[model samples]
Target chain A: MDNYPYAEQTDNELVRLSLSDPNQFLYLSKRYEDKLLRYITRISKFSRDEAEDVLQEVFIKTYYNLNGFDPDLKFSSWIYRIAHNETISAIRKKVARPTVSLDSEDLKNFTDSFDLSRDLDKSFDRKLINQALSKLDDKYHEVLVLRFLDEKDYVEIADILKKPVSTVGNLILRGKKLFKEEYNKLIINKNTK
Target chain B: MKNKNISQIVLERIKGEKIKPISRRIFYIKKVLFWTVVTLSLIIGSFIFSLILSGLFNNDWDLYDRFGFNFIMKTLPYFWLGSFLIFTILGEYYYRKTLLGHRLRYVIVIGFYMISTIIFGSIFYFVGIGDVLEKSFIDISPVYRNIILNRINFWSQPEEGLLSGIVTKIGNEEIEVKDSNGLIWSVNINGASNRNQVNLFVDEKIKITGDIIDDSLFVADEFRSW
Candidate 1:
């Protein structure tokens, strides 16, 4: 395993190799850990420890079910789906803890595009955006995060959520509509105060 | 450092756990077999449902004018329709489990089923599988036949000019029948034009179409085994 160039291997190649050489699975785990951990935290609002526990379970489950993974799908989308399922199950066990911790760099990019976009109010800032997101239902919130923050396309989002691409598009559309409405309501309340 | 540590933890968990993957070929074969069974059952169920509908409409609906809506509804096969609905619901479940079915929109899924049922129903009717399936069920299980087919025995009516039942007593002039509704009807087969064809026997089910002489007696103008 040490002599082989695991870093240069594609995800599919890594998966195929990992089946025979179990130690080669480490490279796959290292590849997805950061991205999946961040995703778990963002989606479920889990603490670092809770997210890590869920992430560990996700990877372990992924390893066991590696044969079941459809090779036609993107590896990232498939792994994210397992993470999404684990996070949802964890949330069911423990009440969702909505933490407002956006990646500053990602937030900057979002704000820049949000300012140019017509769906959201231009006057909104990160704090107001977070408040609106918290107000939205879990379904809308998950779609919005996967779309803008994770930057997954419609098909990728559909694979992760196990829904139709059209449904993902509709959810994003509805999410934007609801986010704007919620943000405006918050602005009104703040002004009255 | 923390990220690598969690990755190691995950790796350790995988190592400790039993991670035997089922052979992909076997997994897919099982899925295909399960889907095939579901599809075949759905086709048969839809065919049977179409037969019931075809049988109902094949009759002279002019009887509806005399019998009214309640009689028509009561005579319609509810059991067959219920089976059709059950199979349709199961078909939706298996359909959504497929790769293409998962990717389809809800509206498209529903539209697909509606179109499929229409196509299958028509093919079953035109191919005559509909009547064959219905008859086969009746022949295979008399208990099932008595319970399901007997409910919509539209042949059992003397007041509206059709009566059918098992022959309880075959007399020299009159044949006694235990009607579907359990009434003993005396059918006057003597001197009828089809009296020669009215070969009567005890315990054999038969249909008689004629004028009702009274509550318990019918003047048989036509007679045949039910």
Candidate 2:
């Protein structure tokens, strides 16, 4: 894996270069490829290959619509928005029930966000947290994933989802509360069983 | 396949397939189009709002006392009001299509739209554009006059002592008027009150309230320009 000589360039600068020479788009797409793949896998039931297919489509569409990118917005948000829409469309086409697939790092991020004790048995807590997240509505689950796991702020989440910042704030607050309640309910059910 | 470089693959696919970025002009045109629709909607909404104001201001409020709430309801500019609402919604929709338009809440957008239309509409109203538009619409569509301005139909009842028409001839104490229904009536305005502040002239539309002396004669107690 060679070091990208243009890695230091700003996204806007890269976008400008990409517009002039299609090869410059390599750096831009490479920058978002891993992140978008993880996002697609997190929000949908696609396998890694399927998620990569979606990511490839996202890159192609993003390149095709490069002229439409508003310079006022962060390139990451714009690309993520494209990735999000493509993943959702793919999910709809596949008719697969969408679910969150949290890995170890994502679980740690989620638990750390809520200040849950790290001392707890990791596997059990991971299962409980994943079940709680799965139980949430798509709106709540998406926001929680973006805010806690992806580490996006309210404004970025709002831009990615094309919702109002205030709505994003409210969703995060309500999502956290709902997640805790669901986690507790799951724990109680597990204890009884 | 799992170990393949996706970006490289996508880049090669791009090179092979000859996919090009859509022209910036298309996006520019789309953005301009959305803004154009929004501006046109706002302008049209302001005009419609101005017409609404004109309708309300030009209405005979004194007749409201005699005719009651039904007269007020019948004379309201529902057509203009409906048009204003449609333009307002269209303005909001197109505004949302603009870049960063989604950042604001619907209430904020709608509130801003309402305030803009009100301010500009009032300006249009005070400048008399509203009246001109109303008159033009009336001229263009008789249905508009008959349906929206039912006041015309209400005033055309000669048997009920309410009459309106264009003045065709003037006499020492009488004016020959042609009503909307094409019936000519000789109106005696010798002692009629002009508290309504109407200027009498040939070809002026006038409304009268009084007794019907005969099929072609009406003695008015009050007369006002319509």
RMSD of 1: 3.9
Q: Put down candidate 1 lDDT per residue, A74-151, tens digits, no spaces.
A: 999989989989999999888765544576765775566455245554564668777878888888888888888788
In model 2, the runs with Cα more than 4 Å from the true position are A118-124, B1-3, B157-160, B212-217
Alpha carbon lDDT at A107, candidate 1: 74
lDDT, candidate 2, equals 0.87
Candidate 1 vs. true structure, TM-score: 0.85
Candidate 1: stretches off by over 4 Å = A1-4, A97-100, A112-124, B1-4, B22-26, B150-154, B157-162, B166-184, B189-206, B209-216, B221-226
Q: Show the lowest summed lDDT stretch of 10 residues, model 2 chain B.
A: B1-10
Question: Best by TM-score, which number?
Answer: 2
Tens digits of per-residue lDDT for model 2, B1-226: 2334899999999999999999999999999999999999999988988988998898888778877998888777777888888988999998988878877888898899989999999999999999999899878988887777767877877777788899999898999999887889998999999856988889998888999998899999998877
Interface residue Cα RMSD of candidate 2 after superposition: 2.2
State the weakest 10-residue window (summed lDDT) of model 2 chain A: A115-124
Classify candidate 1 by CAPRI docking class: medium
What are the candidates' C-alpha RMSDs? 3.9, 2.5
lDDT at residue B107 of model 2 (Cα atoms): 88
Q: For each model in turn, which proportion of the native inter-chain contacts is also found?
A: 0.55, 0.69
